[model samples]
Target: MVAQQHGRRGAAFAAVTMAGAVAGVVATTGCSGEVGATADDRPAGGPRVVREAADVLLASGSSKARTSMEMAAGGTRVTIRGEGGYNFAERIGRLKVVLPRDPAGASEHRPITELVAPAALYMKNRGAGVPADKWVRVDATTLEDGNLVTGGATDPLAAAELLRAARNVTFVGSQDLAGTRVWHYRGVTDIGEAAKVASPFARGALNAAAKGFAKDVVPFDAYLDDEGRLRKVRHRFSYLNQGRTVDVASTTLLYAFGSAVSVQLPPAADIFAGKIGT
Candidate 1:
C-alpha cells in the first residue's frame, strides 16, 4: 500500500531501486569501442566542437533517440534499453524503457513509459505496488545522479549538455554509423564545470549530480556529423551502491533530426502521492 506521507527521499530511493533492478540482471558484453587517430592528429577546435554539442542539438530541434544503460558488478552484467524522441528546444522528452529479461529467460517485464521534463521525471508502470495507471514523479534535482542513471535511461538532451565541460579531448578518428559519416571524439567531462556552463534548465540537476556522483570526472566518447549534430555518445559513470562502487556505461544514439516529439505530463490527480515501496 502507498503511504500518504511520501516525500522526495522516498521517491528518490524508490527510483534508485527500480534502476538497480534493471541493472542487476545478468548479461554479457561490455561497452564497445573504436580506435582512431591520436590527439595530435585531431582536427582544429576539437574540444570546442565537443563542448558545443548541446547547442547544436538545440538548434536542430527534435530527434529520435535510442538509449542503452549497461552495468557490470561482481562479474555480472546487464543492459537496459529505451527508445523515444526529444524536443531539445523545449527541454522535454519521452521514452519507453525496457528492462532485461530474467536470467533464465522465463519471463519478460513490461515496458515503462517515462516522461522527462525540466527539473522533473515521471514514470508509469513502475510496478512496486503502485497502480498501473498511476504515475510516479520525482524531482530531477533531488536525485543523487540527477536522474541520469536513476531513470534507467539518460535524458538525451542532458547527455549532450554534459559534454559542455569536455576537457582533454581527442579525435578518435572517423567512423560510419548507420550509413552516416561521423567524426569520433573522446574526452573527460567534469560535472561541476558543466553545471556552471549548462543551460539554465539543466543547471540544478547537473549541480546535484556533480555532488552526488562518487567522482565528478566522467569519461566519454562522442560522435558528431558534418553539420555538428551529435550522432552518438557513450558516458562512463560510477556511483556508490550498498557501499560498493557500480560501474555504468550509458550510450545514447540520436537520429532523424527534426522529428516531431509530443510529451504530455500527467495531471496532479493521476500522480501517485503515496510512499513507494523499496
Candidate 2:
C-alpha cells in the first residue's frame, strides 16, 4: 500500500480534499434554499443555528494548516491500517502518506510517498508530465463535478461536493472555532471513499485491508461555523485485513471566507471565487 498518486491528477485529489476540508468552503445556497437533515438531525437540545463571526470568516482566506489521517478496514477475520499527513497554504501544498504492508494477515509492509507542489499535484510513482485534471483546472476554475444544483450551474457547493461526499452526515449543531461560533454535526463515512478523496491512495489498499467489509462502520464528526465560513472535522476509521486489525484515526481543521493570502481569483471570477490565497 505505497502512498503514490495515480490517474492524470496524481495527488491533487488529496490536496483538494485537504484544502476544502480545512477551508470551510461553504457553498452559498439561494437565500430561500431549504436544508435537508438526516435521521439524527435533532440532537437533543444542541444549538440549531449559530452565527458566523465576520473576523474569523475574513481570516480564513489563504490560512496555512496541517492534517493527519488514519484508517483501517476489514471484517470478521482480517484488517489493515495506514496514516497520512498534509500541509496546505494558499501558494503551496504538500502531503506525506504511509500505509501498513500486511495489516493483520500477511507480512508485507507498504512504502511511503511524499508530494510537493505549487499549482499541480505530483504523483511520484506515476512519472511526471501527467495532468492532474480534477485537482488542477487549466482554463477556468469551476465547481467540482457531481455537485447537484437546480439549473445544473457551477457554484461553490460544487467545489465543496468533494468534501460533503466523504461521509454520511446525521446531525448539524453549533460550536466555537478560532473564537468564532459555528454549526457542528456528526455522521458516518465509507473510509475507502474518504481516503481516495483525501490521500490519492489506491482503493485496493482499503479493500485488501478489509477481509470482509461489506458494510462501512466509520464515524465522522464535523463543525460548520461562521455561517458556512469554516468547518472542522474528525474521522474514526477501522478495518481488518488478513488475520489482524489496524486502526487509522485523524482530525482536520479548515478556514474558508474573507481574504486570500496566496491566490487571487481572476477579476471576472473574483466574486464567485470568494476571498482565497491571502
Candidate 3:
C-alpha cells in the first residue's frame, strides 16, 4: 500500500469530533452574552496545554476507527474505516483511509482514497486515472494550495483551524473504552465564513467547516485517559436547510499512542513521487 497524506490538520478531524461537549448544552441554547465566560470558559492554561494534548495524542501508538458521517447539504452519507499508530516520544505516525466511489459516476472509476504514512500523501485516482493525474507533495503539517497534485482533494490549513478553535474545555469525567478508563473534555468554536471556503471534496469535511463558521460556534466532545491520552472525539450539528429539526453527528477516535507501530512523516522525496497506486 502507498503512503497517504494524513497531515497534522487531518488529526483534528479525529481529536475534536466531540469538541462541543463543554458547550453542547450552551450551544443548544443559542449563543447569548459572552461565549466562553463561565468557569468553563478558561483553558487549563493556554493554547500550549491544549496543543500539548493534541501532540500527545498524535505521538501515541496504534489506532483504529470506524466512522459514519451524515450530511444534509449534499444529502449524502460517508463511512470511514481507518487504522494507524503514533510514537509520541519518537514523533512517528502512519494512517490509511478508504472511501466509496460515487454511485452516479462511472463504475470503471475507482473510489477516491488516501494513505498518510511516514511518506508523502499517496492519493489514488483508482480507475479514473486520467486528466487529474497522481500524487503530489506539500508540507507535512499544512495543505497549502500549491501542494495539491491529484488522487484526493484535501485542505490542511482549514482543517487545522477547525481543531484549534475548540475552546472552553471541561472535564466531562471518564468513560471505559476497550477496557481502559479515559478522561473526557468538551468545547466549542465558531469558524465564521472561513469554514464555507475550506471545501475538501468531502461533504462531511465541508459541513464541519461551514457549521463551524456559520453557527459562529461548533461544539466538540473529547475523551482522554488518566495518562492524558485522547480516546474519542465527536461533533454534532443541525441541518439548517433540511428543516430545523434535522440534526447530524460526526465523530473520530484515537487510541494506543506512543507504541512501536506508530507511523510518522516519510522522507520528502517519497511524498511527491507522482505514483498513483500500489
Candidate 4:
C-alpha cells in the first residue's frame, strides 16, 4: 500500500497495537548483518534463543513493551514512540502513543491511550484542537474503520511469532540494553509463518522483512538477558510506502514478565459512536 501523506511530518503508525493499531513502528521511530560469527556466537542459536524466549514470555501471562519506529526518506521524517503492556492470555493490551506532529511541528504532548480488549478496540482522546470526551469503539476485526487505528491493524506480537519462526540464526554479540546484559542473535524468518500472523496492515512490514533477508530470510534480532528472558528485538526492512520503497527500522523491548496486565474497554457511556474520519 502507498504511504499516506498526512499533516506535515510523514505518516507512520507504531509497533505495538493500541487496542488495534498496526504499526511496524517505523520513522519518528524505531538494523544489520555479521561476519565470521566468533567463539561465543551461535549461527543456529537464533531460532532456539528467540523461540524459547517467546514461549517463556507469552506463557508468563503479561509483559511491558516500549517500542519506537522511525523512517526517513524523501526529505521527510516520521516517528512513533509508545510505552505500555499486554496480556496475551487475556488477548488484551494498552499503549500510550506520542504521534508525530504536523508539518509545521506545532503540537501539544497529547498522548492517546489505546485499549484493546477481547470484544472491542477503544481509542481515547484523539484529533487536534479537541477536548477529552470519549473513546472510539471498534469491532475486534475492523481496527481501521474509524481512522483511529490509521492504517490497518494487526497483532503486535506478530513480531515474536516471526522470531519464533526464524532460521539460519547467527549470534552477533553480547551487549547491555537498559542496564540488562544480553546475548544478541540474528535470524531470518519464513514468509509462510509470517503470513499466518500478518494482517493487511502488517503485510507490507512482513514483505519488506522478507525482501531484506539473506536467502529469502529477513533478518531480525532478539536479545536474551542473563536470566534468559527476551528483553529486546529489532527488525529492518523496506516497504512500498506512498509509491516509494521506504526503509523501516523498528524495536520492541519486553519486560516485567509475569506482571499483571489487565486492560478493559472503557465504560459504554465513555465510548464515542459518532463518525470520525481522516
Candidate 5:
C-alpha cells in the first residue's frame, strides 16, 4: 500500500521513534507545574513518572531499536528493521533500514541508511536524481520551508514533543516484553502542545503537523525498564489522511542499552543538499 509520505516530519518521526527506543526526550516545559515526573523522594505514576524514566533513558548512551507502524483498516504496513541507535549526549544517531520487498512487484530490497545530527540530516536512496552511494544532506534549518507533511504538522521532532505533552499518566500492571521485565504506563497527550515547549532539536523549526491528526485524545501504552527507560511503546491513533481520518498503530521496541552509536558527517563531495521529495 502507498503511504502518505511525510518529508522532514517523517525524518523527525524516525528520529524520535529511534529516540523512544534509544534515548527518550526532554521534559514538558510549558506545563511544568501541571506535568512532571516524581522526584526520588516520592514515587508516583502517570505522565510525570514515565517522563522522568524516559528522560533518564533518553539521556543514556545508546540503544538498539526495532520499530514497526501500520495503518489500521488496510493501511500500509511500515517496517523499520535494522540496527538503529543514537547518542543522546552528543545529539547524533544513525538508522540502517532494511525494507521488505514490495508486494506488488518482484523487486529486490535494498537497505537504506541515515545519519542525523542537530545541524543536518543525511540519507541514502531517498529521492530521484540522487547519486548512487551518496548521502543526501539536508540542512535542518531549511527543512520546514517546504511541505514536509502535506496539510500536517511541520515539527520534525513531533514524537519527542508528543511524549513531552502527554497527560493523564497512570501506572498500569507489569509484564514481560521480549524477555525483559517492564512497568506499563498509559496516558493521553495533545501531540501539538510540544510546539509551545522549547527543544534544542524542535522549537520554532516546525509547522503544525499535528493539525491533521485527529483531535480526540490518542492513548498510548509505554513499557519502562527498572532504570525507568522506555523499553517498548505501542499506541493506537488516527490522523487525517487526505481529509480522512486514518488510524495508525505503531510499536517501538528498545534494547541493547549503552551500545556504541557513532555518527559522523559524510564526505561533502558525496553529499546532496537540496530539496528532497520521496
Candidate 6:
C-alpha cells in the first residue's frame, strides 16, 4: 500500500488520496472417493485446507459481507466499517464504507460506496472535490497495497484469495462464530506466492502488492465451516508511512450464502476523469 498521508484532514479525504495514488485456483488429484473429502477430512494438514478457501467460497456462489479496517498512525487509531455483498463467482463486490469521524469530532463523513472489480476500484461519494454522482476509478494494480488497505476496506474476494498462499498453518481449534460452528486456523502468507496461484482476475493486483508492500509476509487468521466454506478472515498488513511503519488490521466476515449480489460498474461517462484533490 502507498504510504498514507496524515494530517488534520478527515480520514475520508485521506483515504481517497491514498487510494487514487496507486491502485486463485486449486487442483485436486487423487482417488475418486478421496476427491469427495471435505477440507476438514483431508490429512495433508492445516495449510491445505486453508489454501483451498478461495475455491470453496467461489463454489458457494455469493454471500453477504461485512468488513472492518483499523489503522494506527501517529499515536491514534481509527476503524472503518463496511457492509455489502459479494458475488464470488463473478469476482465483484459492492461495499458501503463508513469512515471514522474527524479527529476533532467536528463532522461526520458520508458513507462512500465502493465497487471492487477485476483490476479496478470505483468509488462514489469519495469527497475530495468530486461530484457526489460521479464515480472515481483507480486501477487496482497501481495501488501499492493493491487496494487491500488503501480503500479503507479490503475487497471480500481478495481477502479470501489471499489465503491461497497460506503457509506454516496450524489448526487453532473449533469455535462457534455467530451461532455457527467453525474451525479456526492461523498462519502467514506470501503475496508473491498468492499471486502466482490466484485467479486471473486477482493475479495482477496481488502481483503488484507483492512488490509494493514493505514486506511480503502477512500474518492471518481464518475460520471455515464444515463444508469447507470460509466464514471469516483477518489479515495484518504493514506499510511505510513517512519512514515509519504503520500497521493495519483488516477483517472480513461472510454469511447468508447464495445471496443475490448485483454490481453494475458505472459507465465511462460517469467516471470522474479530472484530477483528484488532495
Tell me, by lDDT, which candidate is best: 1
Sort the predicted structures by lDDT, highest score first: 1, 6, 4, 5, 3, 2
Clash count per candidate: 0, 38, 41, 23, 10, 9
Alpha-carbon RMSD of each model? 3.7, 14.6, 11.3, 7.4, 8.9, 8.0
Candidate 3: C-alpha RMSD after superposition: 11.3
Ranking by TM-score: 1, 6, 5, 4, 3, 2
Candidate 2, superposed: residue stretches over 4 Å from native: 1-62, 70-92, 95-163, 166-168, 191-217, 256-278
lDDT against the true structure, per candidate, is 0.79, 0.31, 0.38, 0.54, 0.51, 0.75
Model 3 poorest ten-residue lDDT run: 19-28
Minimal lDDT window, size 10, model 2: 143-152
Q: Candidate 1: global Cα-lDDT?
A: 0.79
lDDT per residue as tens, model 6, 1-278? 12122221122223535432211011112202212335565344567879998898888889988888777544566778788999988889999888777667788778889999868888888767788789888777766777787678888888888999999997767666676767788899999999999988899889877876778899998878878888889898877654566667888888889989998999998988765555
4, model 2: CA deviation in Å?
A: 6.4
- lDDT per residue as tens, model 2, 89-154: 232333333323333435542222333222223322221232222122221111111111100111
Candidate 2 has an lDDT of 0.31
Question: What TM-score fits each model?
Answer: 0.88, 0.37, 0.49, 0.67, 0.69, 0.85
Model 2 TM-score (2 dp): 0.37
lDDT (Cα, 0-100) at 75 in candidate 2: 30
Off by over 4 Å in 4: 1-45, 116-121, 128-131, 137-156, 197-217, 267-270
Q: What tens-digit string does per-residue lDDT give for candidate 4 at 141-178?
A: 23211122232222345556566567777777776565
Candidate 2 local lDDT, residue 35:
45
